[model samples]
Target: MIKNIIFDFGDVFINLDKPATVNQLSKLDSSFCVSGKMNEINEAYEKGLIATDAFVSFYKSKFPAINEASLINAWNAIILDLPEYRLSFLEQLANEKKYRLFLLSNTNELHIEHVINTCGSDTFNRFKDCFEKFYLSYEIRYRKPDPEIYKYVLSENKLNPEETLFIDDVKENTDAASALRIKTWNLKPGIDDVTMLKDQTCFG
Candidate 1:
């Protein structure tokens, strides 16, 4: 009996070109890989441990040839379209009020800004209004696959792990949630659409 639903924003709802940023950056620096100090800096930024300007500055310092605009564009290139059908499904779910709905996403400021700018304020607001609690990684200073963040969400909402279902595109994230006794759907991007929730037995 699932009484609450937790969702991942990317892939599960909004589409993302997960490899676009890497590809774009690789063009700028042939040896650029998501490793070493870069990964640490990204984690720090996602955790809201650093400001947006600091993040941009760090990249600027590393890739002097790349201008701020180019860096920002490459960083945000991963964000793509948010299909209307998904939004419609979410809006319907919200209206039904059958269960507590929440959004937990590992996102940064620039990406969020891109989403707002691309999706338009009214559409974005509609999507936001669907959630009872919207947890942004940067804003919350917590991220997925970190058990503490899941614990915090459960504790704050007074939700029972047994009665909650978390849906995410990442297996690692879903695995972490499952470790806490929360049911999860590790949805495959192309094969599993969020709009097809009724097909999932957990929801049934």
Candidate 2:
């Protein structure tokens, strides 16, 4: 029986245009591609190994033509809408207290700031209230698909892997969780809305 539920915050909850940043950056430089040291810098930033100022400075230095605001905008373009229905569903689930609910997300500072600005503090706080534990990659200094992170969640919460269900949009992330004996739902964005989670037999 599943006693705990872990959810990915990106596509599983908030709508994200995963390719928007890449496409947007390419417009600034036709030859722009996330490569070499760029990938390293991004990983470090995501892991909270670097400060936001350093991250912005690196991009500004690389793309001198792009102003700080423009660069931040392009970087944050991937974040999109968070539907009310999904929030409602989560709230209902939380109130029921049938499962231990947690949120695990691989996110950075700028994107989180964008979410707060776009979603407003009250709305975001309500959403956050629905989870027992909220794990942000940068804050936690750990990310998904890294077994250690999953281990940390389980160990910290004293959760049994066999009694936990991990839900994420990325197959690789779900796969990693599965390796640790956790059940998972690799939800498809358009077709598998989280509001319809009850339809899945696994929840039953």
Candidate 3:
């Protein structure tokens, strides 16, 4: 029986349009995509290899012609607001205490700041209180697709791997967790809904 559930924060919970940000950045500077600077900056930012300020500085330095405000806007274009229905679902699950719920996201400070601003501090706080443990890659210094991150969660919680269900939008992240014998759900966009999880027998 699944005794724990791991939720992914991005597309699995809050909708994120990856291409929208890339397209916006491309509009800011055609050279961003052409020069491959955007990819370099994002890779460094997401991996926690660079601080938010340093990441912004690196982008600004590369595109010295572009203003800092525009660069900041382009960088922050990824985050979208959290819907109310999803928030209610999470609240219900937490109240029920159906399983030990945890949230694991491969996120950074800037993106989180954007999320907080978009979702509002009160709502974000309410959402946060629902989880037994919350894990963010930047804060933890360990990212998804890295086995160590999953291992860290399991070890920190003292959870039995076989009794835990890990859900994520990305296949690679779930695959990593599954390797450790954790039951996983690779939530597909528009295909999987967290609220619908209650109807499934797989989860207790």
Candidate 4:
């Protein structure tokens, strides 16, 4: 019956330029590579293992050419605006109270800070108020497509896997949820929008 719904934040509700960070970094340091060491640090930062200052410091130390302000700016280049229509849809869905709603996002401190700065805290809270439970990777210290994060959410909320639907823009994330018997829609960003929920077969 889909008693519960889990939604991903980036690309689902908010617009994102996924390649913007890498592109921005490359511009700062001509030899920049999103490889090995940065991947490890990035994953750790997302999981809350590393603090924000330390994160920026790592980049500054590695590149040596980029300062803290520019480095922070480059790192946050991937995040974009939260479309008003999506928020309107989410608010309508939440107000209906037909199903338990949740937000599960793999995000970091710098990006979130930028979002808050751009959107304003009150506006961000308005978006958050739509969800029954809001889970951020950095706050929870767990990120997807890890099985643990999904399991934690299911267990914490006492949600039945069969009655839950998880929507994500990433196939690997959706696949992980499906493995746990949770229904999923691997939504395509430009081709499919979250506001088209009623059109999905899972919604039936």
Model 3 per-residue lDDT tens digits across residues 1-204: 988999999987788887776687678777766357766666667778888889888877877888888877776787777989999989988898768999999888888988999999999999899999999888888888889989999999999999999888899988899899998888887887877776656565
Model 4 shows how many backbone clashes? 0
Ranking the candidates on TM-score from highest down gives 4, 1, 2, 3
In terms of TM-score, which candidate is stronger, 1 or 4? 4
Off by over 4 Å in 2: none
RMSD of each: 0.9, 1.0, 1.8, 0.7
- Model 4: what TM-score? 0.98
**Which pairs of residues collide in candidate 1?**
none
Cα-based lDDT for every prediction: 0.93, 0.92, 0.84, 0.94
Candidate 4 Cα deviation (angstroms), residue 178: 0.4
Question: How big is the positional error of residue 120 in model 4, measured in Å on the Cα after superposition?
Answer: 1.6
- TM-score for each predicted model, relative to the true structure: 0.97, 0.97, 0.93, 0.98
How many clashes in each candidate?
0, 0, 0, 0
Which stretches of model 1 miss by more than 4 angstroms? none
Q: Residue 158 lDDT in model 4?
A: 100
Comparing 2 and 4 on lDDT, the stronger one = 4
Alpha-carbon runs more than 4 Å astray in model 3: 34-41, 200-204
